[model samples]
Target: KLPPDDRLAVLLGVIFCIPGSRRAAMDDSEEDDRGPDESPKRPLKGQACRHTASKSSNDDEREDGANDGQERPSGSEGSPSKKKSRDNIPEPLSSLHGLVPESPPRFVSLEQIMTTANGVTNMMLAHEIAMDDTFKLTKQEHPEKSLEHTVKKILHQAFWQVLEDQLAENPPNYDQAMQLLQEAKETLLGLLLPHNTSLRAEIMEGLDVALVRQQAEHGTLDFGYYARLLISLMARMCAPVRDASVRDLLKIEGVVPLFRGIMDQLEVMKLDMVNFTIQEARPLIQSHSVAYAREKFRAYLETQALLSPGLDPLVHTRAWLRRSHEELRALSAQYSPDPVLNGRGASGPPFAVVLAKAYIQLLCWDPSWEYPETLSMDRERFTLLGAQVEECALVASVLLVTHSVGGASLQDISDFKEDLRSHTRLLLQGCGKCSEEELTEKLKCAASQAIKEVQESLQKHGFAPLQLSQERMLYDQVVSMASAEHHIRKLLTMRILDFIKLTLSSASVGPTKIPAGLSTLEKELTQIAGTFLRLVTHNRAVFGEVYTDIMAQLRAT
Candidate 1:
């Protein structure tokens, strides 16, 4: 067996052969034929020339593999990088053939640039070894000149190869090696400042000195050191302005708008960088994010207290939403490294927000509440019964409010109050009626007509039909609430008719006799109307001008 060092070098060279093995042997022969005056041909920029040579060699190897009846791995076709790596692995049976002394030694044609990689690594290691040897040896001339010449000669060639390796990946490991290249550009700018008229000036203008130096100094580049440097550079590049005068200028009300514009641009740039990072990490990110979300949701469901049958469905819904939001937030935090699928900010709402929203919608589609199967409403308490399904309407209204705004500002509260007052006044005036069946039927017909009129009025006010998902949800809630209110009103009207019939029968028996519950019924009717009025007012903002027009018409009737 060969010595460990030579074995490792041969191992690396063979490993990196790719498709260049055949060409390397042919090139070796051609170089031998040429006179001593002709130097070996150097690999071109970007290592494209060497890779092209490798491709030809690999095609032959692929055919050999096929002839030998080796099956190609599935999914390798989609990933050229993977396929290349797979092909680089030499077969055990092929290696055994090399042991036959009767057969000639195998001609492993590793790419020319890769063949030099070990040399570069050893050269740097030798410098370190020389430093350690200096402790024991006396004063000696440093080999800096020779070392520098060797490094300068092959530095760019090695860099292109390294870069090619980095780029040829699906989710490129762009953290350190790429940053070294970037630093090289920045360092060259500084290097140029100090050398205004040096011979290096022309080369430095187009060359990456930092990258060349980094490759030469270390046996293997320290990814950790480069990563940290990248972080610092990124921070400095993206740091907030710290100039006192500029900050003071920004604080001035007159200059605020300009500052706002600057801030907007900065924010946009930040988001773009975040999106780019997320895109690059997509391959590294696994399908586990979806599974993680499901797991979290399941955990939340397990911990929920759903044993109480007395709880209103709306109350249960609110509880569920609150818990789901919390769990979703945790899931989002877990997936902070992954790209957000819902177009939310990196730290915006949880990944579960979409899931929770869906749940809310599903629940709202068939919302249920505690209500009597048949309202046994008396004339005296008929109005109270009208408010029986008020909780359902209120719950729907609350959802609308929550969905519309994350946080209610003072202006929002003020607007809500004003709308409530206006809507309440209109509803009370229109909805109030003396308890009687015939008039109730008339009001019902009028309400139906008014509903259509309200919708038309909304269109006239330049409000577009609900198109956004949120807008549609809010509209659906409005229709549900209206349907529930209509049902209650009908039940109340029937009770009033019952009372009127009873009063007429009693009056015939005793001419001066008043119905026992006439006064009480009237009071309940007004109170019930007031309750309905408040509900209508609370939701008028969502329904818009259409609701206002309908309420106004109903009041007029």
Candidate 2:
């Protein structure tokens, strides 16, 4: 018997050999051709191969060898030449000659196998052409045209058909599908890295289709796939080898075609019955790998500011605002009083709000060289946009406050006043709704409970407690004051002045009210003035005098 290492080497040579073992013999001859001074190819030496093969064979042979009446060896070492010749013999010829080899199967290096597999994958993806008799005359008349025509004909029939077949199969055989996808991705990535412009475009078109189909078939999308595709495409578009090409491709005029193509595809996908939300889609769209794409696109727009005259930033800003408005309208239409509302169409408006905010912030903080002309315009537009957002926030808060205050007693209202005051102060600070016109308008539309909340908060903060009749009369007066085009300014001034005066006077006479009944009257009068001051300061125009008068009255008292 041959030694195990010799047997393995012989098996490798035989397995790799061409038909008739010509290549194997040629290999041996090539070895021999080396001069005597050259060292001989050393055989791999070790008991590792033998022990492994023997143990595996022994396990399988115990059952099969018994049926064949073959004797199993007891782990004895075999002769080296015997083992070599036995393993080197081709399987078909060995079977014919009734020879059995005591050697392990041949194994190839993993890298070699992977390289071959990748090659096969490429072939499957290659574009092809076909021959037809009808094209013979045409080819003879126009050889160049014929060549191009033939190439396209072959690609459509052969390459396209294979892709169609793969796409048609539902839940594609994962291994085969992944192999093709991987090969295509590798090809595109390779072309992109080298900045091959024309080739990269072709690859990108194919990759886009593959990605869409993959998402559709899988019924889900992953952010990573989109990230890789965007990064590769952006790199090719920006590479130094194609600096001029990159600039041209990224130009506002030049990018329109690509942008339109992508937008068209997005619209088509939107019509799909799948319930994919923007929240689910955003991470993929805004991923770091594609961040450069956004930057480049924005830069292109900025460049247009120099070229195009009177380009309004509001055009894009308005588009975003309209989109958010439409989303909110849709949400209201699909409203449902169920927890599941969080899933379907309900989450869209919030996402739209977030997207609008992000886009606005980007334009507002833009540091690109071309942004100076447009930055002021964008900031003004966003400020106006913020007012709309504030209105929505206030409306929502009002609803919550109304719900919370329902059917509560006076004591409950008193206890809740602090909480109400805190929320009201927060809303006032954040919403920028302190203007007389805005404040009056808000009060006119406010729920009765919300008005009561304001009143209770005012009284609890040491503002005077009006009689119920007097409070109702004041509420009507404020509502009328809010409605009038002319009266709102004066009403706001007087109300705020009264509030500040009341607060200061009460503070000046602290604990004096508890000891003397007459001081209680003084405290009530002070509280009234404080409440009036609070209202007037809501309008900046009247704030100065109302503030001065309140301080003057407190000092006099």
Candidate 3:
């Protein structure tokens, strides 16, 4: 199988050029008709030629199964250069048959570029969802034309009308009906497994094309009998969810409409079969995905080596773990002498801890520092999680101080707590992403809102508002929370970080074991912790060796 880059190239080639089997035959005929001195045609402007690789039947499937239900860009692991590998690349005529033939390279038209782009996008989406237990293929509904579903309605109507007119003749033509019967039989057979011997025999005997043809010749053609039988077979073969659709087919009357309904139901059943196969294959794919991904990544790196030249593809990786590496080192210094075999990282961080450190970095990741290339599959997810972590931290810490300063006056007021949460969320929108100056300004507003909620709650509960001196003290404490050095904010941050550390330390850990001062955010923090831990655990299993090697190099330096 080709690497991801070449696989994309093959997709581009297939849509733009003739299929290999037909193109080869055409070349042979053209050579026979040409004179001895004749030269082959050259590519014109906006066209180019190159040697194309063949795509294997299972290559795309394997590529999807190789990842942990995510489409990681090929360069994320081995991207050593800024220039893309596909830059100014020539058009390729892919070989989809067996081996790539040594036939002369052919020029390709640029007409199907969008089609190839769409195909690649679909392949990525398939990879991202293949492991989902609830994954199912649903029939796509085409939208109406001119503000109505005229296009689909028109096509179905015209096709059925053709069959009706053909069957209305004196001799009663069965050609279209015969073709429909053949297509239906194949579709039914496709829905069955190899072990379905009895059902297979029944289908073949019941819908025999020869039997229908003979019936037509004798003018005893029973269209109603065939239609009823097809519907009965479909009701038995289809899923329970499709029982309603099968019943709708049964409700239909007349030869034309029934057959039209039968054809549409057959298409739906085919999709169901495909979904069933994916569900059956998911466990096997997931079981072997780790090893498969390792190999796929290895091959990708080899390809990137030629494209990237002398630059190290893992530059960001080393930088990502550099800070954690120093902390772990200094912590080790306070204990004892290090273990031998440093390169294997015997005294270094456990793979789980390494990933935990990486995840923590994600929560506070500097936008200026590039994300680790190895973890690129979850970049967007991390960015979102970072925003949530920052917002939750800010809200929880502010609310804590608010409750303490407001005392029992705000204790029983659930509405007061909710108001604080809403105001905090609004003010902290895009908290970690926007400029620090802007975030500080927003945080100041958040502080004021917290103090206001507490005061409003006290007055509503028939308690006096904070005295002037008390109000000034509470305001100063809350506003100072905007700074990173704020004591109350730092305490809350420490508690949240500790809670995360506990969850990442063990696979069996649960969200129930929340640290003190973070109960207000237990649910949100637990979800973030769980998601981060799961991704890091899987990623560590895939790239633990790489992490070990990088750490050993850092220690040596």
lDDT on C-alpha atoms for all candidate structures: 0.35, 0.37, 0.65
TM-scores of the candidates in the order shown: 0.16, 0.22, 0.57
**Model 1 CA deviation exceeding 4 Å by range:** 1-264, 275-287, 294-485, 488-557
Local accuracy of candidate 1 as per-residue lDDT tens digits, 1-557 = 55433433332232222112322222321211122333333322233433567766776765555443333345336358866886997664545655743332222223322223334332222222222222111212336668845774476446545655654565544443444444333332322223455533443443444664555355454434433332333333342542332333333342223322333333333333333433433332222222222232333333232322344323433343344454555676677645553234333443233223323222122324322111111112334333332322232233233324222332244444334333433332323322344334433443333334333434655544333454444344333433435553334344443443333223254423222223323444344334433332222222233323332332232
Ranking by TM-score: 3, 2, 1
Ranking by lDDT: 3, 2, 1
- Report the lDDT tens digits of candidate 2 across residue range 463-491: 55445765465446434433324343333
| Cα lDDT of model 3 by residue, 1-557, tens digit | 55443443342232122212222222221111122333333321111111112223344543444442343455565343524554556545555567565544222222122233333333333333333447554554546455335864765577678789998887778888887887788778768887999999999999999999999889888888988888889988998999999989878878888888888787777666666765665564456555555555555555445445467778898888877776765666567454453333455655456557666877767779998877776687778777777667777877787788888767777788777777877777777566667777877787777767777778888998887777777777766666776787767776777677777776563434777767767778889887777666767777788888887776556
The candidate with the higher TM-score, 2 or 3, is 3
**Predicted model with the maximum lDDT:** 3
lDDT of 2: 0.37
